[model samples]
Target: MAPAPSADTLGTSAARARSAVLEEQIREDPGRFRMLTGDRPTGRLHLGHYFGTLHNRVRLQDLGVETYVIIADYQVLTDRDVADTLTEHVEELVLDYLAIGVDPERSTIFTHSAIPALNQLMLPFLSLVSVAELSRNPTVKDEIAHSRQSAVSGLMFTYPVHQAADILFCKGNLVPVGQDQLPHLEITRTIARRFNDRYGNGGTVFPEPDALLSRAPLLLGTDGTKMSKSRRNAVALAADADETARLLKAAKTDSERHITYDPAGRPEVSSLLLLAALCQNRTPEEVADDIGSAGAAALKKTVTEAVNEYLAPLRARRAEYAQDRAYLHRTLREGNERARAVAETTLAQVRTAMKNHY
Candidate 1:
């Protein structure tokens, strides 16, 4: 065996390895894989969510991969001081999923708070990870900085273990992730390997899942920072035509008159152009070239119109789904039941392997 790489090197290699592997396997036999991907139900998903993972999710499902999405309600409590809005956020997140083309029939969608069996796995999985390891995770560090809080909760620090439970509960072997999320997935892989080594009797009980990186462009916030709900810069996925226009119109732009795609030099202008490009399914350079010599006002107008037009059908469908609250409730209820059964089976195997089942 070769010597293990340094922490930084391992992080870089793992980020790219699974992505390359999945790209080859995807075209050959997508059905042979099981994928897990989802979001925290903190707010309505935005354009970043759409391009980031949602589109790849739909593609994987249509290609016959068994896919499971979690509206991670429990994760929201990590940094949040109140729980009053969680219920509302989870519901709106499901609507956003449906509006953006996540079919309940093809993909199983469940709330993290409802899955008892999955959460139970966290106990044994927690034992497999060390505090030193958890603290060293780059993603967690970045999250802490982003939270900008003096005190961080225990739940927030150990959320990656919970994430492992989320993936392994369904025996997921393919997780669609971005480069930024590779550390979390690496921890998941470590827990799986540790569990199998400790418990398996010549038969691996858990598979080390790999990352499937999407080529989707990351959309910056209107203020040129990372787009997020907490930042109050995100445009929700269900934003109506008028709402979309309003948000785009107010987005920050450069003082320069000419519109260009120089992200490093003119992030504000490039961010708007990037938004327009993604909405129109074109390159930022193409959009910039088309909008040649236009000022910030012209750039914002073009982006606002493009975004509103793109979200028009989604808003209409969301409105229809909103009217039938009962249907949404039923969809979630049925999905939770379906996901629980799978979690129970995996948990049963885990218990048997660990000699915890009596």
Candidate 2:
């Protein structure tokens, strides 16, 4: 529609585009954009895992918006208890983020356990948000259904409040989310407004966090189910060539002899093609056109190869970073310090707003 911003200036345009609301932001406050997003350090990241949300994080950081990656270790307890595996999972999660080129120096990457003030903010956040609100959170509902929880925990139910705290603690106004999480952020926005209505008289302590909906595709699992670790249908980012081949071979495809991209009718085949396209950074339609040039067997082989090659460097980097525990700890320590200071600033504002500083 507009003469596109040059490659140098495009980052400026793309950064704001992450949120539909953010698009209107540049017109109002061009330089005030901030982003927050992260994951529970529950398991290894897979191919279909966070790549969709993550690519946007990398690019947005390059575009000059403040970005934060919260390693939500405490959120892990809501669904299951991996008490023995907590330390390993947290460390691996950090390593995975590093291996994927999420530079901590540019972005603030910190663990939830490390920040006391932020956790303190969560208490006040929980007070303002009700049980009914928490119960209706799409993420919580999805998680509870997946956990098949007969009895849900207070922690699980309050995840959205913590999420609001995570963003509000950092004064982050923009969050990258998949379509499914839109409602969660809407909850966060409501809480921000409710908090402001109840709390803000001179000025709002919390920024009403907005959703930066990712343009990335929701990757389907190998069996055409959701690409989740629990389903055992995902391909881990750290998967080797042999593992990739095995998974690809085992992946469910259509009854037809050849491949096709009819998602409703041929979901399995379309999923495989989608995986291939994502690896090559192309589209399923483009891959389908090339299926004629390469044939079905060749398509599978090519797709598998493309995926393996794309992840090879990251896998290799993971091995290198894994060997250096001190390196990770050092970076994390620095990140924690930076994040703590930032959160403290927001908390100070919160205290002053509530007249609790005295």
lDDT (Cα, 0-100) at 126 in candidate 2: 76
lDDT string for model 1 (159-239, tens) is 899999999999999998888888899899999999988888777898999888777776788887888888999898887
Compose the digit string of candidate 2's lDDT tens values, residues 1-358.
Answer: 8896665356334444656666566446645877888888767888776567666677677667777899998888887855578888888888888988788878888999999889888877777877777776767888788784568787888888888888888888888777677767877888788878877885676777767765676678877788887788888887789998888877776657655678889777787788788878888888887775455566678779989888998899999999999999988899899999988888887777778423
In model 2, the runs with Cα more than 4 Å from the true position are 1-31, 148-150, 293-296, 356-358
Q: How do the predictions measure up, each by TM-score?
A: 0.94, 0.88
Instruction: Please list the C-alpha lDDT of all candidates, in the order they appear.
Output: 0.87, 0.79
Alpha-carbon RMSD of each model = 3.0, 6.5
The Cα RMSD of model 1 versus the native structure comes to 3.0
The per-residue C-alpha lDDT of model 2 at residue 114 equals 93
Candidate 2, after superposition: displacement of residue 269 in Å?
0.9
N/CA/C clash count, model 2: 0
Best by lDDT: 1
